[model samples]
Target: MSEDDEDFAGCRPLLFTIAYEILGSAADAEDVVQDSYLRWHAVRGKGIGHPRAYLVRTVTRQALNHLRAARRRREEYVGPWLPEPVRTAPDVSEDVVLAESVSMAMLLVLETLGPDERAVFVLREVFGYSHREVAGLVGRSEATVRQIAHRAREHVRARRKRFHHDPGTAREVVGRFLSAAGTGDVGTLMSLLAPGVVHVSDGGGLVSAARRPVAGRERVARFVAGVARRSAPGTRFDITSCNALPAVLFRVGDRIDQALVFEISGGLVHGMYAVGNPHKLGAAVTPRLLSRKGHETWKP
Candidate 1:
């Protein structure tokens, strides 16, 4: 690859990640990353003091702008909008910042902030950019950036739950829930949920799913179980890794249906996020999975 192409290649992951976190859509993030790369190419070898920082700045600004437009679209969204579930590698489980930042709960909290606040928080809090660097990237005074950072930090802190990563506990909880669900055992499923458990499903109007968050232990349990009982006769479920945590992947024939991710607290499941939006699933699922006929086989 040429030097400029090489530079873009080296920084692509960081750029895409920043965009994804800010916009909550891998598809939008990909567009932002590509736009940033083009800008980088145009200004390449122009005595840029640090290419990496420049790329970060470019990607962050692009993402923030995209986020502004996205907020408007979200107002018109047909159902509860969840962050696109991106497949994370195993090593992400060990990175505390990554694990916490990408969690469904955290992303939902981030959604509460303004575009600028989200950008500052992602750059200053999650990615560890200095206040001055973030100010330069977002074109705000360092003092202003610091103030925004503090506000954003507190906003997220107040809303986001502090989750202790317990992979062993998570795996066990997910396994038990899956077994209970597959057997259509509502009582067993209810026993596994926390008293104030919540279930959120994202279908993005392209498939079948709950339009609003299902709250309460008994309601959430039955919500999950009712869907479980409606699965196709030969539907198969597998325990797999998704978003750096143990999750259950449902499949029917060759089509990957959905990924059910559970959030555990103490010994019970506190939150369940079912991502059935074929658009959100992206290339991770087969073409068959996106078909309306396939999606009708079950719900979550």
Candidate 2:
């Protein structure tokens, strides 16, 4: 086996972890990891030790570059921008880490940080990298890295109370949310939402959506009930896990029309991310029951 191949294999998991932390989108994270590998190979013929650290640095830098551009684009975004949701593996050995690293709430909060600050925080806190290591990776002095990380920490701490939902409880809450939405039951939906729950939909201007985030249980409930009515007759919905939390997927005539990813806190729905853009649905896989052509099936 080539040295580069061995090194890449050893660092794949860590690379995904770092990318996910920085970008908060599994699809984007995978793209960044692939890009990192290409860059690694381009320089592979050159002798280098500590391949693991080298890969980490390369991936982290690529993620930071993406974050820089993403931040600029979001400033003028049509509406609330949300991180892409991911489906968790059934066995969640890293549930706690995922809670902190991949939560929708944490990712949204990360949007407040500068690219460099986000990189430093992810490297030091999420990956356990030392200040010196982060400094070297980010091309900053150790003291500067320390300061950036500290500032990022304070920013995150200010929003910590907003992300205190247990993953298990969040799953149950989402299930109830889907049930309420499916039956067009406003009371049930209102009961599940926190008094000040926020609903942010990203139709990307291609479809109808709120121009800004809709806050308050009554508003969110009314919006969801209206959505339930527009769904094509015989349309089916399922509550599935996405991005390490529970989410609802709407299927119409075999095509997945929408996926509603959420953030729960204090046993109530605290945040709502509705992804209706067809482009965003590219990563969604067909459910097993619908695999066969003409099957016309949907399952929760």
Give a tens-digit lDDT track for model 1, residues 100-151: 8877888889999999999999888887878998898999999999999999
Count residue pairs with overlapping backbones in model 1: 0
Tens-place lDDT per residue, model 2, 1-300, is: 786677576567667767877876666777998998888889876876566667777888888888777777768867667776665553332446645566677777777788898889877876667899899888899999999999999998897544666667877887777778878999999999989898889787776777788999999999999988887888877777665566777788888788888777789888788887665665544321100011112110
- Model 1 scores worst on lDDT over the 10 consecutive residues at 288-297
Q: Quantify all predictions' global Cα lDDT against the true fold.
A: 0.79, 0.73
Write down the worst ten-residue block by lDDT for model 2.
290-299
Please list all clashing residue pairs in model 1, or write none if there are none: none
TM per model? 0.90, 0.85
